[model samples]
Structure formats: C-alpha cells, structure tokens
Target: MIIRENSMLSRRHLLSLLAAGTAMGGAAGLTTGVAHAQAAIPDITLGDPSAPVTVVEYASYTCPHCAEFHSDTFKDFKAEYIDTGKVHFIYREVFFDRYGLWAAMIARCAGPENYFGIADLIYAGQGDWARQGDPAAVADSLKRIGLQAGLSQGQVDACLQDAAMAEGLYGWYQENATRDGVRSTPSFLINGDMHSGNMNLSQIGQLVDEASS
Candidate 1:
C-alpha cells in the first residue's frame, strides 16, 4: 500500500493559532481542536457480514462536496449495496479542521449501531454547525445533537478528550489515504481500486459490478 504525506497543517497548530485569535475565532478554535482529535483515528465500517465487495470512503464532515454526495447519491448506493449485503461500506473521517474532527468523534461515540444515523445528521447539518462561529457554541450544539442520538453529555465530552483514540484515528486515516492515493475529500476505494470526487449511483454501481465480477 502506498502512503502519502498530509499536506494540510497539523490540527494542533491550527488550534493554537485559533486560540491565539490570529487566524480563526473561538468557534473556529473549538472546531479545529475537535476535528484534529477526530483525525487522529481511523475509518469505521458497517454493513454486510459477508459481502463480496468492500467500499471505503475518506471524507470530512465540513466538505460541501462530501455532503452533497451523501445527500444525492448515498441513499441509492446504500439501498442497493449496503442494505442488500452486496457491499460492506466503511466510513472514514478526514479532517479539514477541528470542527470536522469533533463531528467525527461525536458520530463514533454514538457507537456502531447509531454511527450512520449520527453521521447522516452531521452531514445534513454541516452547514449550520460548521459555520456557527463559536467554538463553545458549536461544541454545545454538537453535544445537544449527540444527546438527541442517545449520547450523554459526559460520554460526548469523554470521547472528545480521548487523545489516544484521536491519535489512532489519525494514524489510520494517514495510512489508508496514502494507500488509496486519496488527496481530497470524498475519495473512494472499491475493492482496492481508487476513485475520487462525488460519484453518481450509476458510476458507483459500475465499480461495484466490476469488483463483484
């Protein structure tokens, strides 16, 4: 597997800058920190105990394109592939900032059963949460969202502060992204082949067909 060096600035440095009120505001600071923590982990998979095809996605919650893909194309894909046991879908987090990572952790903390539900909400609400402009406020909003999804405030807070878990996530993303030649958000790996950008259902279906064959 090939690995590529991350070109984005480190999450810690971005958070420090935000805290200092240099590049970003308080909201941005919180988002950056949380997103960094999320980045320090790897992708999580769901669907199909014994599928022939595996589809992995490297995505960021803050990415508009990723959100669009989720909104427009994912339902069909899930219905056809994920739900029917033809494909095992893995969702990996890639952070563009702290907010993105924080969102990822919140989704993960919901546990595997609820991970996709929370992820859908995050992607759907990405515009509102990411642009809220107050780190504490954004965190609180996310906390509330998590609570609605059955996560306690304590659970969300604990997950957010999990440095070791965050590091593991980052390491996993780093390695996977490298191996899959992913340089941008919404990149995909279909049975070890790489495809980038937001793809239509037909395009993905074709890839799935190829993989299965």
Candidate 2:
C-alpha cells in the first residue's frame, strides 16, 4: 500500500488510535514541517556500516509474514551475517495500518540501542498484540511491550503523543517505499535490487553472497 505525500496524518487520528493506555492529554500540535520532520527521523541500522553486502528490508510490524521472518529466519541470518559484520542490514518499517505505525513508534521509543530488541519482542508477540481487540486494546498491548523492553511509561506515552514525529514517520515511509518501489511487506533491497515476501536464510544468503561478488 503506497501512502501518498498529500495524505497527512492528523493529530486527532493519532491520539484516538493510541488513547487506550496512554496520556495523550498532553499531545502537542504538529508544528514541525513534513520535510523537517522526515529529516529528523533516523534510520536505525545494524551490522558493519562498510560490510560487503548491504541489505535493506522493508517490513510492516503488523504483517504475519514479517513476524514469521523475524522469528524463524532473522536469528540465523543475524548470526551468520549481521553479528559477524558480513552484512550491513537495514530494517525499515512499512506502515500498512495505524497498528503497524503504532508498533514502529513503540519500538523506536526504545531508542537505537534497544530498537532491534524491542522490534523482536513486537514480532514475537504479533499474534497477540496485533489482534488484541480494538485500536485501544492494541495500543495497550504495545504499551506493555514497550514496558517489557525497559522503556518508562512516560517515555512511551511521550513518543506516541509526538504529533510531529508521527507525521514525520508517515512522510518518511511514504517517500522511501514509493522511491524503492516497495508494494508489499517483507520486501528487500539487496544491493539495490528489490526482492519481496518472506525469505529464508538460504535465499537471503544467496542474494547477499551474490551482492558481495
């Protein structure tokens, strides 16, 4: 799903989506311009910055296939490449819905140091949290995940209530996904080549090896 540039996310929608377990009463206006906001959002990455293979993965937090990839394939892949500095891995969040966006916000709230760990937790519990009743319930589940990741309640609430950050993430995702021709979750840009769907370790390794060559 391609989110167009003109479709700006409103603060009211963000607040409502995450109002269940948060103190959004202190939510502020979207004062920051989209361009500036996008610039402020960082692309948290892993592995060696100068590794031979550069793999950019576009995945939605609410995607079941993405969850499967994270749970089953990612550990082996990371052990073989990321931890050993053989691959420069970049994980970009694709927001197919407000739920996915909220999840990304929570994972990001943990900061870069704990970003991947929080993301793993989100994926590990996707079946439960993503389907936890309504929008408010989902928000509550995500808040619990944030807490489990050692994030303070105040930090999670603040991150979710940041209208500017939310807008920026939306704009940034739209721009990146559109530019990279990402039409689905669990998509990969292996050395500038696009690959889609859930990929196993062997498939990824083959592509990474080919890219390295």
Candidate 3:
C-alpha cells in the first residue's frame, strides 16, 4: 500500500510499464470548504474553489469499489454539496496498475475542464471496457471512450505519449498517496482526515456539514 521511492512508479519503471502498456492498449473523487492550495499536487478539482469545506478523493479508474461509489453515491453527493458550492472536491489518481495509468491519461486527454465527465464515462463503462482482459482490447476501448468524451484521436494519442507528464504524475501520486496513507481506492481525506472504503451520501453529507460548520 505504501509505494515508497524505490517502487515501480519510479520514472524508469513507469517508462518500461508504458512500453508494455502500449502492447496492451490499455487501460485503465472530494469536497470541502476551499481545500488549502497544494501547488505540488497535480489534481483535477471541482466545485467552487473558495467553498468553505474541501473534500479530497483518491481513486483509481479501474477500481470496482470506486466505480460503485461513483455510480451509487456520487450523484447525490454532487447534487447536494458540490453543485450548491458547499464543498470543493479534488480528485487524485491512484495507480494500482498500468491499466489505471492508461485510463488516467485518457481522462486527462480532454484537459481538466472535461476530466470529470470523461471519468464518469470510464467508470460507467467499466464492466464492458475492463472485463475484456486483453491489454490491446482495453486500450482500444479506452480510445473509444475518449472519442465518446469529445477527444480526437490525435488528442488521445498525445496524452498517452506524454511520457514526461506520465512520469511527473507517478511522482505526484506517490508523494500524495504515501503522505495521506492511502492503501485503497475510494479513499478520501474529508477535511484532512482519511476515510477509506465506500461511504453513503448521507454519511458524506453529515461529514461535510460538520466540516463546514
């Protein structure tokens, strides 16, 4: 769970993984009052930045538990908290494998403005895209996802080939995940306290109310 400095996420390891991932095709949450700025983390954020409560989510694109949270709980939470500007959400990626990294690249392909929307597509289609179990098939499916999300093939390819960006993201995830003691997907730092596993909207709403109050 603790991926230290010597872990496979080192730039060299990631590059090698990328090469292997290419043969495979691929693949593949938060809130609160304004979360304090962390310039070092490369996160895609949502809601009002100046909102009173900041909620941070750590998740992987290929994680089933994460998908369930997105499918069952996130809609209500987003409606009640994020849209109303009661919480600011920051999404941090956790790379459990190369497939996850590939998924992340696809989400980032459309750029931050469309990142969450693309992510929703990824999670919603997880059953079809990830169950194929062929790296090449998975990769193709992810590109289709990118296309569905309004990305050109060129944009998707560019995002996938950005080795430097991928390496930087590896380090970014490593540092933040370790610092926050994140050992699993669907983990959250609700106002800076780590909460792991799935949580209902009501549970999350109460936490947000408490943090913002």
**Which residue pairs does candidate 2 place in steric collision?**
none
lDDT of 2 by residue, 1-213 (tens): 333234334544643454433333333422234233443688889999999888999988888888989999999999999999899999998776678888898999978988999999999999998986576677778889999999999887767666667767877787898799888778999989998888899998999989988
Residues 1-213 of candidate 3 have per-residue lDDT tens digits of 232223335545655656664443333201111123222335799899999989999988877888988999998999999999999999999886767887888898777889889999999999998778676777788889999998888777666666556666677887887799877777888888888887889887888898888
Off by over 4 Å in 3: 1-11, 21-41
User: Highest TM-score among the candidates is held by which one?
Assistant: 2
TM-score of each: 0.80, 0.85, 0.84
**Please, what are the lDDT tens digits per residue for candidate 1 over residues 84-180?**
9999998888765667767877899967778888888888888888888877677777777788888887787766665555555655655766667
lDDT (C-alpha, whole model) for all candidates:
0.73, 0.79, 0.77
Q: Rank candidates, TM-score, best first.
A: 2, 3, 1
Off by over 4 Å in 1: 1-7, 11-43
Which 10-residue window of candidate 3 scores lowest in summed lDDT?
Answer: 28-37
Q: How big is the positional error of residue 7 in model 3, measured in Å on the Cα after superposition?
A: 10
lDDT of 2 at 29: 25
